[model samples]
Target chain A: MCDSEGSCHVLLLEDEPMILMDLEFAAEACGCNALCATSVKQAMKHLDSERPVRVGILDVNLGEGQTCEPVARELERRGIPYILHSGDLDRQNETVRSLNAQLIPKPANANHVISTAMECVGRKCG
Target chain B: MTDDEQERSRPSQAMGNPKDFDDSPERFRDENPDARFGGASEVLFEQAMAQTRMAICLCDPNKPDLPIVFANKAFRNLTGYDEAEIVGKNCRFLQGPETDPEPVRKMRQAIENEDVVVVELLNYRRDGSSFWNALHLGPIYDSEGKLKYFFGSQWDVSDVRAARAEEHYAREMARELSHRMKNMFSVISGIVNVTGRMRGIESEAQEINDRVQALGRAYETTLDDASAGRIEIGQAIRAILSPYDVGESHLRLLGNGIRVPFAAVSSIGLVLHELAANATKHGAWTRDDGLVEVDWQEKGEDEQRVVEVTWREKFGPKVTIPADAKGGSGNEIIDRLLRFSNGCIDREWHEDGLVAVARVPIWKAS
Candidate 1:
């Protein structure tokens, strides 16, 4: 599912600037190109890009009452697997429960996080 | 002192507070309640009801609109309505626009069923100020089981409701703070990750991130249950070790009920994570058939109370015991972390694998 460099294009969705930077670096380290989006609008742009997104890592809460559910649903529709990297992981949260992606709780190893998303390539995520 | 001043200094020995007696003319005005019972027992009961601080009201069901026929002095003070203004009006005058319709509906149904109903609702006073009213309404029947009147007791529970609201607010604040704390940890690790990439020290940065994540996971164990909101030593151990678990026969978690102090959870997590990584590199996890068992328990009583945990591995090649094993960096970390928390550990290189025992002090048994 990857090119000769064991590389793929990954969508990195996070509102926090520093965390986005880390995810970008992590994606690059795993030998993939990162398409970083700070807002849901930017995320949809990445999803719409012709270059195509092979996998994704999403943040749950985006502040100001926004969430990653819409982006996750679009990714699920495309059959592109994504991982949920959240600071506050509540299984009881109906939105999070319905998103149904693999969860790697926050403050986790950055490289480990991106590489796991790499492993999710071509797998059913929703 | 004058005679009036001397009498004012003395506690009132009247049958009841003279002020209450002066305000309550219901004994003379309301004949419906007196008709039901007219004995010494009824008189004594009336005296107690008249003097009590609780607001009491009796409404006659037989009257048109079921008007309030009897209201004690406290009821007048609570509603700011005198006998002239309150006696003929229905009890529904206390309800305001903000009052919830559900409780009102429940009260109506209870009255129709002739059952007792206890409700708390927003009630307004004659002065237009609102207070939470904890009201108990029930029917008072005669010897023949025919309902005579409905007695209502009211208490101002504004302070109680406010305290409960404050508790709910505190829980929300705690949840928000915990959410931010998790994000801060991630941001910190993110900084390390990006900086490490720029400095070409990605591996070292990952080691630091692993430690940070262990701390986060430890804190998360407590966050899961907001009520107790305390981490069990075994739960913290299982969370940090879960990442290293590679399918079957990897790690076994065995312990329950024994908890770690709130402050020491992260330290214990780091200590266990470091030791587990060490074992993975050179101990049991290095072998294909290897297994690691992490067990936690509480031992001793009273002054000797301590939380003891053991991390033992098996089915790996044994290595030579170093002469400077006591001075190793692993033990130094374990020692320092535990010492700050008033705890200690013992490590041994058994023939099969590495074994370490940690004893963390607990101020109070949990």
Candidate 2:
């Protein structure tokens, strides 16, 4: 849920600028706070922060042979739920499967993205 | 006997007393007490050896280099060498630079121990062309138990090895192509979704765009990495509701993760999208204080794991039941989707807000 300032506080990890913008818009449209990260390193910084993250939306491949697995693992370890967003068809990596996180494929509708974030935080948008 | 006379008399002697010239002298002597050294049996044996398809050669172990003593017609043809050219040379003359030393060493070890050995190695013919030689070698002992000679047989297997390599390459190529094609489909689908949402579109166009977008979303979840075409219940719900901007403080969701069949993603997404749009316009999403709570859990003890999902709207504007709420397109779609999944849906209106519950069989024993 958002504070008085209307920030619901979500961790958004994506490499592509356009996709990141879409995710940001979706998070804000649903009245959730958006904390954006463009790479695994940046996402890890957000994860390390003291601020509470209600949920996470992660892109599987972050480019240059990097993945968001570490971010996903950290979220799971902290009991924070997350959803996977990827363009690659092969999404069944063993590490991610073990976490049992929800997968949302690329080019997802804003409604689906926002609602998934809401659901992760134990909320229903529709 | 003089050398020339001995050679001249051999054929007639072989023809006259065939049993005397048997390879196993002791066995021949036992069977024929009057056995002699010359017979027609030797001529018959030579004819058979010359006609056989397999290349055959005999090496004299008593000779310093184990020189080839006798070679059949097949052996001469296989090596492109005549009897005069090959007889004085050892069989090792067939081996070339490319031949693996390991098998050659094993062959030597087998010979030293007087044991049989079979080895495949590269061998060269008189024209300097190489071929794979599957060579089988064994010792031939005299009647007194002396190792008198070594017998070797050869066959060509170059074509078989080449065919296997080609098949392996083709398989690798096919796998690579499939991976590339899958990524291409995903890219094209992403493009369609992005293009459909462009501004200034008419209602009819937007509606079509929305349906296509819903399909894209369905494809995303259904063809997950596992490619099993099943969507997790919580994820499906979230994906369906993602486009709406229901304030987080105003929405609540609770559920244990469950997966549903792929066929249900689009229909269920459409229903949830319709409900959220309605709520945003006139129901729970209208006020900052308005809230919607959705929860789901697995039910029943049958082989199929059933999921019951509840959507409850609270603290919203008083809702008047729209005429279509009972029999609208949205309601029809929801009903059809539920029925397809072997599930059902029910809705209730209370003073606080509207509440709807759907029960769906998401998993079977399979």
Candidate 3:
């Protein structure tokens, strides 16, 4: 029942433009439509739209001390699964860790990150 | 104010080295005008306290208020007070608004209890400049168990505290630098992927991305215990295999206590990642029921010690064995990566899946 012509809508939230484009390409490669957002506000806006975002990938730190935790909690509320991707997640990042998401560390293979998301989508759909 | 606080400056006493020194309580009081404690040891003790560079003083407890009855040259020098300004005064003259009250309270409670206590507090100099003073004070009792005096010693620890502050700042700066370094790696890989996607070189981009990630994971392993200069070989393997170990009980690690120097961690990690990526692509991890068992063992003795690590896959689909195992481009990558570690790897197909074994030489820094 997705609006993008039966294609899976994947949310890609990252501060870096290059990373966002990279994630979009990866989502496209996985046969999903990428809903890219550089900030939490835009991400929430995308979520507020009736588009079905089946899965998400969030970068923990979004520059200037901002984090993707709010988006993560929103995704959790909607029962959508996601992966926490970051480079500088301090060892004691229990607050975000409590979201129960697999951390696909930065510099991850595009296929690896996308396939992990597809696996979550499979568990939710299959 | 007590009578002790009003006591004025007196001429400094001489450090006695008399020709006919007698070790008797009778001789102790004869020449030692500063002999407050009544014992044969008072002469030696008084001379030692008076001349030694450690700031020391004695307060009379028998008086209505504990008053400083004696102040040594070092005490006067440390507090920037002459003998007269310090003697007969409770050391509180040195405490100012900058002084923390907790240590003062601790010192007061210990003095009331007649017990030994040590604390660091701010104390002002004669010019009113504050210095951190490490103060140790305790009750001194005579042979008859009577409280004779309260002994107080002082030392300025401003330099030590400053050095500690500098160390904490440097540690914080190092953490910030390391965070920036990790971000640079992420950004570099991002650029690689974004450009690689436009150029239609996704597979090539992913290969570079994985190798970068492998290097990042290895660098992170070194950070866990950088001061130790070594890490358990199993821990290094676990970090590399973490990608495939998720979602189920697919990875079985069996080895302990075998350590590897940090110099070899990245190369070893690269080799392990190469094997794990191959397995996920064409070998065992392709199925849900597949299991990858990483077993390591220590071989040889002392200088000849070598670590033999075997990656054994179980419960997977059948596959054709590569006729020339070590000659393939994939196997060549594994060999080249392990070369930095002075290690070699071999791939062999078994009944279930691919099995790769790596032997790494370990130094006898045991």
Among these predicted structures, which one has the highest TM-score?
1
lDDT of 3 at B179: 65
> DockQ ranking from best to worst?
1, 3, 2
Off by over 4 Å in 3: A1-12, A27-58, A66-84, A91-126, B1-83, B90-119, B122-131, B134-163, B224-234, B254-263, B282-308, B312-320, B339-342, B346-355, B360-366
Kindly report which residue stretches of model 2 are placed more than 4 angstroms away from their true locations once superposed. Answer: A1-126, B1-44, B141-146, B189-366
DockQ per candidate, 2 decimals: 0.62, 0.12, 0.47
DockQ of 3: 0.47
Which docking class does model 3 fall in?
Answer: acceptable
- The deviation in Å at residue B105 for candidate 3 is 7.8
Candidate order (TM-score) = 1, 3, 2
**Over the stretch B1-366, how does candidate 2's per-residue lDDT look in tens digits?**
643233334443332442222223333334335334457765555445645668887787877978877666577678887656777698899999899999899989888899999999999998999999899999988678888779899888789777878977765555444434433443444344344445533344345545555555544454332344466867767655655544457667777677666655555666666667667767788888888888888777765567777888998888777666767555677787778777788888767677988887766554
Best by lDDT: 1
* TM-scores, one per candidate: 0.77, 0.40, 0.66
lDDT of 1: 0.79
The CAPRI category of model 1 is: medium
Better of 1 and 3 by lDDT: 1
Give lDDT: candidate 1, residue B212. Answer: 82
- Which scores greater on DockQ, model 1 or model 3? 1
The C-alpha lDDT values of all candidates are 0.79, 0.69, 0.76
Which 10-residue window of candidate 1 chain B scores lowest in summed lDDT? B20-29
Task: State residue A57's C-alpha deviation in candidate 3, in Å.
Answer: 4.9
